[model samples]
Target: MRKLISESFFFCSFFSLFAAFSPMTIHAAVKVPVQQMGNKTVATAIGATRCLTPAMKSLHAQTVKQMEKDMAQVDAVVYAKAIETYQKKLSMIWSAMSEPYCGYGSRGMTAVKSSFNKSVNRMRAEFLAVTKTAPVAKK
Candidate 1:
């Protein structure tokens, strides 16, 4: 009985040491909460969005690329018309590269429009996933 107890105690001590020294699990912090993301979508999307007359083909390409990423974050249809107006400003600028211009400035702007849809859809999916998950899973 004495030998058996000592053996069990030794095993328990080894197990405890191993467990204490094991690699820890880490969790990443969420950047935005689901509840707040919807509110920020439009604001963040258009934050840096603007159009400038094409200085050169390269500059025009870069500016428009950044602006599209910004504008594609709108979450509602009410703002879509405003986006359309901003985008419309581009049409007048291209003919005169030296002239500064304003707006999203596209005739069709299909790519920005598509990215906007993609962002909204992805947000919806993420929100849905969070809503469907277990409310109280222990760490």
Candidate 2:
């Protein structure tokens, strides 16, 4: 009886300690409602466009010039590829952000938003990269 009790206590203590030191994920506090998510997407897209405005201008000028020229297929191809990547990233951002968690809604939303932001940032970066403008360079 004494040995069994001691063994049980040891096992319980070991489990407790293991749980205490185990890696746990902390969630975000922001809970974006579903309707709000759409608004957020639109707002973020607008913000992204505004943020990339100068770069967009440069790209527009370059693209116009390229369009006027007969041998700008490479530029078109590059633009298409970059745009495709940006679209894919945008989709990923939305898909990841749309996960719904009952108890961890806020945390999940935060994680999703963070992921979405990263994807948007990457897409913006790719746009700027293709445009080759320094105006949108990170601060």
Candidate 3:
């Protein structure tokens, strides 16, 4: 019984030490607000050269590509109207991204990427709905 108790204690201690030093634990402790992170990402992407990071640059390129793909699936008129509406919503997110935060590190870039992905997804959904209901053009 004593040996079993000692083994259990050692197991617990090992796990406790591992958890304490884990990257996820450290990240959780220093968690920044999503809005702040995203703002830093956007600011870095569009801001002056000094503020830009490679991560933000990559994210900006990915976002542009995704937006273009989303816009390509619909008719020209539908694409134009949908893009206008999508841009309006994206502008609000861009405004949110203007807030101050930590530099555009991995976490901040991830948040920005997430926001862009969500925006694209919403735009795609809207385009699909509009196309489905729009009158078919007789070629």
Candidate 4:
């Protein structure tokens, strides 16, 4: 009996240690459709634009132009493939963020709106800082 108890204790300890060290995976609370996520992203971007100052908007345009130029340097096919992958990853992120309120109704929608506003505010601050210190292109 004592031997059996010792073996059981050892097994429990080993299992507990293994579990403690195991990697944890996080999952989204709800599964949002890709189409819905896309729509939400577009709406969010449009709403966010309203919060940007004129200078920030100009900076954003310049940044986008520079990015497009940089992308153009890459092979067309390769850039297209990369963009596809990027879009897929972005969609996944948006879906995850939208998961919580997927079908919850008005309260869930309110939560989503609150979350998007918070995210937009954070992004706006970051963009403002970037625009303020970004270097001007030499003619």
Candidate 5:
């Protein structure tokens, strides 16, 4: 009976130590709320745009010019592809930057995607607005 008690105590101690060092426990320490996740994505997006070099800005200008041309031709497919690619790239960058905070878990990813969709739609609209306002070069 004494030996059984000692073994049980040893098992309890081992399990307690394992639980203390578990990934779930560590993750909880750095947990970011879903609302804050959206804020972070917006901040990151703004920072990304602000950090763009003149060359990058020029490229964006060219893209806008091209988009204006596409619009004149009523190219729905081109708009779809451009927006999808832009969103995917932005999401990829945001995901890599946010992994530490949001985690590799499905729930965390869903939160990031949901909040990003809401926050990033404004940028999408701005892109469309810029293309509409900019003059299209003659083909």
Candidate 6:
């Protein structure tokens, strides 16, 4: 009985020490809820950016049509004002996704970070090409 008790105590201590020193269960101090929320927000924003591209093109076409129609009846100042408004809207839409913060404070999940960067770069380059080629009316 004495030997059994001694062996049980030794085993318990050894197991406890092993658990305490285990590499698989290291606890981090940071438990910020905002980090996860920020990830969700970033994902939604990126999704919105992707979803809005077609709508943006449609709106751009509609604006160009209106501008063409307005140019016929409006003086230079009025046409300039219309063009300025359109340009401002376009800038705002582009700027919305320019500072995407999907990673926020995170070192970021490797696969997600890679994919997000790829998508953002692809879209940015496409946008840059489009803007470069798309004619801007003089103010």
**Number of backbone collisions per candidate:** 6, 1, 1, 0, 0, 0
What residue pairs clash in candidate 5, if any at all? none
**Winner by lDDT between candidate 2 and candidate 1:** 2
Candidate 2 residue runs with Cα over 4 Å from true position = 1-78, 100-111, 133-139
Measured with C-alpha atoms, the lDDT of residue 79 in candidate 2 is: 60
Best by TM-score: 3
For candidate 2, what is the TM-score? 0.31
Candidate maximizing lDDT: 3
Ranking by TM-score: 3, 2, 1, 5, 4, 6
Question: How many residue-pair clashes does candidate 1 contain?
Answer: 6
Q: Candidate 4 — which residues are off by over 4 angstroms?
A: 1-93, 98-106, 136-139
- Candidate 1: Cα lDDT at 131: 39
- How high is the lDDT of residue 101 in model 4? 35
Better of 4 and 6 by TM-score: 4
TM-score of each: 0.29, 0.31, 0.41, 0.27, 0.28, 0.26
* 2 against 5, candidate with superior TM-score: 2
Q: Kindly list the per-residue Cα lDDT of model 6 for residues 1-139, writing each as its tens digit.
A: 9999999999999999998777755544323233256437332322232323454456446645644554454454534544455455545544543354433234434533444445434544443444344355889
Instruction: List, residue by residue over 1-139, the lDDT tens digit for candidate 3.
Output: 9999999999999999999999999977874433256447322332332223566556656756765676676666745776777667655544445545423456766666566567657765775676567665679
For 88-111, candidate 5 gives per-residue lDDT tens digits of 654554444333443324564455
Whole-model lDDT values for every prediction: 0.48, 0.48, 0.62, 0.48, 0.53, 0.49
User: Which residue window of length 10 is worst by lDDT in model 5?
Assistant: 42-51
Model 2 C-alpha lDDT versus the unseen true structure: 0.48
Clashing pairs in 4: none
Clash count, candidate 6: 0
How much is the lDDT of residue 105 in candidate 6?
36
